[model samples]
Target: MRVGIYLDDQGRSLDVVVEAARDGAKAGFASAWLTQFAGWDALTALAVVGRDAPGIELGTAVVPTYPRHPLVLASQALTVQAAVGNRLTLGIGVSHRVIVEEQFGYSFDRPVDHLREYLSVLGPLLRGESVSHRGATLTAVGAVDAPGTKPPSLLIGALGPAMLRTAGELADGTVTTWTGPATLADHIVPTITRAARAAGRPDPRVVALTFVCVTSDADARRGWVAQRFAMVGQLPSYRAVFDREGVDGPGDTVILGDEASVERQIRRLASAGVTELVALPIGSAQEQATTTDLLVGLNTRAG
Candidate 1:
């Protein structure tokens, strides 16, 4: 699997995100990703980030698609692409109900329909063509005005079968979080692959995100992770993936163990058809350092 690192970008400045990505690349990570948190916008930050580390792939685990019109997002992504020499993967999603309806005040009704329409507009615009679409939830009548060389690949944060169908049809692949290998092999991989083959699209890229902490104190760290991500199991989309993997919560899917154990589970993710793994290192400072050291070692060994 292509090993990537997830930088902590919540509420941090663009400079910090860029710095962290640079640091990760220097540490021999195959790619580095940023989340769509409250601080710097992921793609926008990557405009400058890739400059700090010339060739590393920089991606957003996702930026919510509801707020930005596809035309607008396409333009922004293209801008980042042109700036960074096309080292961007635009991961977009119809985010959770509370965040969309409550936080952003956007209606979360008919999300699958919304994502379908959203991708229809987004795909054409990314290809440097005009999109004139009018769906139930959104409309776009224009194309992005940007140089679209080396078009960034698009990934949907798809968890359910319907969403996976949409992603396989329209997007380059799916980006997943709190999803384990069994779920990927049994439910996620099959659903998306079937859809992609039916649509005659290229094999879908599966990027799995799992929290990892290389620690001697596995149980204590797992307890911390459970409390930290306690709310994820309640989220409908993530909960579905958890249910598929027979996991009770997000914490259950985390890959927390000693170095050998952690690497072995990571290899299982690859076996289960994960094209890339965006490892979100969790735990205390010491744990983080140990995990980073192991990841760096793996990258070096691969090289």
Candidate 2:
């Protein structure tokens, strides 16, 4: 399985973010992905990454699909893809209710329907084709200028059944967080792959992001992890996935332990059909570097 690193979003400057991506790439990591949130836009961050580190794959853990139109995303993704010489992966999502509806002043009803129509317009617009559709939620009637490179791979953050099927039917792949192998094997993987085959499409790639901190101080590590779980447990979307995985909370899905245990768990995820693993190191640079160095070494040695 391909191993990548997820850059931290908290209080990071553009230069710092670029440097982090470059460091990960030089450390033999396959890719460096940036998570989108209120603080930074994914495309802008990746443009910096493209300029700073050539030849390394750059991606958005996800850009929310509610506020921005897909045409805007297609244009920005193409620009970044060209800047990176086609090494960009545009991962988009219909984000949860709290952010979209309560925060952004957008209605949260029928997100699945909205996403279906959104991608319908996005696919053609990204492919440099004109799009004109009158759906229940979205309607678009033009195409953006294509960048020099073809559109980057379109990945969606899907955890639910309808969204997973939509991802298979339309987008190139699905990216996930806080989900486990059993959930993937029994629910997500089969649902998506079957839908893709039914549509005469290639099997969709599955990339999962999870907390990966390597430290002997289990208490400190658990404290770091608990903070994340507290927030995630409150989210209705993630809680449903946690329930499906039969886990108590998001902390259960995190990959935290000694190096050997972490390695074994990641391999189990790969065996369960995860194509790429984007490991999020949840501590300072020194701590992150320690885990990252070991993981990169292990992956290279395995190769």
The global C-alpha lDDT for each of the candidates, from Candidate 1 onward, is: 0.87, 0.85
lDDT of 2 by residue, 118-171 (tens): 999998888899998888898788888865778788899998999999999998
- In the range 65-173, model 1's lDDT, one tens digit per residue, is 9889888899899999999888899999999999999999988889999999999888988889887888788988987777546679999999999999999988899
The C-alpha stretches of model 2 lying farther than 4 A from their native spots are 283-287, 301-303
Please, what is the TM-score per model?
Answer: 0.95, 0.95
Candidate 2, residue 210: lDDT: 87
Candidate 2 lDDT trough over 10 residues, lowest sum:
217-226
Clashes of each: 0, 0
Report the Cα RMSD per candidate. 1.6, 1.5
